[model samples]
Target: MPLLFIQRALMIAAVVSGLSACSLRSSPPSFTASGFVADQGVMRVWRIDDGQQRPLVLMSVYSPYSGPGTISTLYEYQNGVLYQIKRTDADGDRDSIQLRFTVNGTVSFMQRQLATQRQKLSNDDIALYQYQARRILEVSDALNVGRVRLLQGHWQQGEVKLCNGEVVKPGFDKQAENWIARRTTNNHQPVSLAWLDGPEGRELLLVANDDFCRWEPTKDTL
Candidate 1:
């Protein structure tokens, strides 16, 4: 009877947890050098214009802890509004484009559809959002669907407009390289991510490990 009870309990657990017995043995992915735990993927955020250090994304590897454990996410901002987000977890990955948001608020895995219009460039030609949401919609759509992380091997490089309206190329630095190496050696960090320079010069940074980060420029900066 005890043997039957144990088997039944295990089966019940699999259903309740939405995981199979075979899957339980599989470990979640994690980064050792960049410190991205498959269970603790997150986005780190900072207002480059402000002196305050705000870690919004847990995935940055440098980002302070936040959001649901095991959820990986990225963020992008336009005019201080966090309108776009991409995230992943045990269930899978998803993108959320919000038309509305609360002040300094965050979201889970819900997604929003972009209202676009087919523009007539010529009698025989048409394009998406030639007029509608042109300023940001196109830019948002052009971004990569998903960025694995700092140690995923494929590092991404690009221009990021800081909160101060200053455009800078953000990617690997000597400090990060050394930091990652040391962490890997000590087994304190495991994930891989790119270290980017912020608009404030070499002293500051915009980490691109977890995903995209939002740069909230102040009124004057805009």
Candidate 2:
């Protein structure tokens, strides 16, 4: 199966397992948006968005063997903030916790395990670390475009170069043309798509440093 398919299956499994246990009189927690909660040494869920009642973040800490160890630290991004759900497994039982905090103007998720229940944090300590999530949408929006190829580089004989510049050898790829165009145009700050001649056919290129014009590519036939 495809990697994405496998990953999705795993995620679904985790979600189902997490919500599996509930008595008839009790209602499972509703997750309005993605968030976290701090349960009784079992698991924690944190919500990053306001006005949402469900868990946007979930953490469970578990150590399954005779010696002390940690399995994984899971992070989920909701409402443009990264939240953490940590699990601690010790002896035969597992203790999990979820937290969302703000530091240095950034949101962070954390989980820690203690040798004993007495080591758990106090209410004041939890309050001190409690905070709202900052916006992470900025980063995603910034990197929306994948990659760029400055100037029109030729892939002739495994060599590449900026248009009107000396040639530099580079790797070749049949599927990389689209990626190259997006990256190059964005980096050059071209308001519109650039055109260029590609290894396969005609294409677009951008040159912001110069005329800020597009480069069109045509296949040369003998």
Best by TM-score: 1
TM-scores, each model vs. reference: 0.22, 0.20
TM-score result, candidate 2: 0.20
**Residues 1-222, model 1: lDDT tens digits:** 012322333343334244223333443232111221112222222222122222122211223234333333344444444544443342223322222234553332233332342222231211111122222222111111111112122222334443334454545457755644443563432233333221222321222334332322222322
Candidate 2 lDDT, 109-190, residue by residue in tens = 4444455553455555444433211111221111111111123433333345434555754443445555554455536333
Local distance difference test, candidate 2 = 0.31
lDDT of model 1 at position 3: 21
